[model samples]
Target: MEMQKEPVGDLQLHQVLRMNEGDGDNSYSNNSLLQKKVILKAKPILQETIVQLYSKSFPECITMADMGCSSGPNTFLPIWEVLEAIDESSRKLNRKPPILQVFLNDLPGNDFNSIFRSLPSFHKKLEEEMGGEFGPCFIAAMPGNFYRRLFPPRSLHFVHSSYTLQWFSEVLEIPLNKGNIYLAKTSPPGVHKAYLNQYEKDFTAFLRSRSEEMIPGGCMVLTIYGRDENSDSSAKHSPTIWDFFGMMLNDMELEVTTPENHKLSM
Candidate 1:
């Protein structure tokens, strides 16, 4: 969707960018199988990083931020993985479990209320698994843009993002990519360049902001959906599922969009 350039009146990217949210049947919390799979694939990395960080610092409290944590079942998956890792590491080292301060971050538009309502069961499960012996863990909502700094300097111990960085901070018009939402066989050279340039700019901002927020020995685990540069950008062998979704979006655009109200709205 095309957006007006930055002026106060222009819609902010954070205001517009988000997954379907709520507790309904088709909401992100209910129908996020792909996102759940992403969390599983990154589980090993998250566990390893948690162990390493805990062993190195052994801080009384571990402050973790799950960036782009859209509200859903997948939002807390990393928390479980890391907690198990820390529990194991602590036992092996003869140390007590560290207290956890979990921050679930997303744009202001995310359905944090649904996540909040579901917290009791999550904490209950934690108690069921570790009993009262494990250090108390707390989860809080952090609403903001990841492209900007959201924490005090050197405050975060661990950071994680899954299928988040692929989205651009702003959805600008790419007139060159006619008939395609992304780079495809029919796309012109400029279309690919525009996408790559935007990705590089947004990623640089993310890294720079994160570097300041994370401590010296802090670690991060990130998983992105992407296609190989050399491979054909078709649905058959592509690693990402955007090809199918993009086609669906294009159809919707054609069906409903008009010259005056072309931009999509939820």
Candidate 2:
């Protein structure tokens, strides 16, 4: 696999950020309802795209990828949805479904083991759900940042991502904004420009990389958080959330510096 650059500026995201793993309360498996909802909403698009793909040309096998496929029960939802789309189209067309080759891509640190553990259930569910109608299905993991090349040219026919690209490759080393973990309405124009530049670069890289890997006529369905149409680029959804965080931090700093707290520490 070709080495990819950090998704956030120079910061290596694979090292620092990952969905919480395992079956604990914090695990992505348990807490990914919103992500799942995004995937569910994309189903109609997926179905339409697959139908068009079949109409144009029927490949012997369908190459599908779920980029940023974090380790969790939710990881295989895209695979299942895509397969269902293909199956439905095949039925409509009175044609046999194509073999399904799925690539689950995520950062190297993602809990692939958890995903692997869930594979048996995934397979069993597919069999029970589709039986002989479903063609041979092969699922594999590609551990790398999607901002870089992860597959060979013309290797994929479909790609999907949900609620992932909003994260930049890294945090800006220079804190342009005074008291925000992410872009906020209070951020200056320069800070906003810096973030927009990072986003454009990262999103461009993501598209370029995918273009190299996907065949002509391939389809990509992705969901990302965006500012409201009426809102400016700097106006993120949670403007006050960060300000509250900043206030809490300031209070903690004052508490630590107080005479009573200082004396107790000494």
Candidate achieving the largest TM-score: 2
Off by over 4 Å in 2: 1-13, 229-246, 258-260
- TM-score, cand. 1 vs. native: 0.86
TM-score on alpha carbons, each prediction: 0.86, 0.88
Clashes of each: 0, 3
lDDT accuracy of residue 190 in candidate 2: 73
Worst 10 residues of 2 by lDDT: 1-10
Note the Cα lDDT for every prediction shown: 0.84, 0.81
- The TM-score measured for candidate 2 stands at 0.88
What is candidate 2's lDDT per residue for 1-266, written digit by digit as tens? 11122336344556767888798998888988988888888878877887788778988898989889997767887788778878888888888889988999888778899888888888898899998667989999998889999999989999888888987776654335665555667666776787788899999999999999999899898888786636554445543656787768767777988999989998
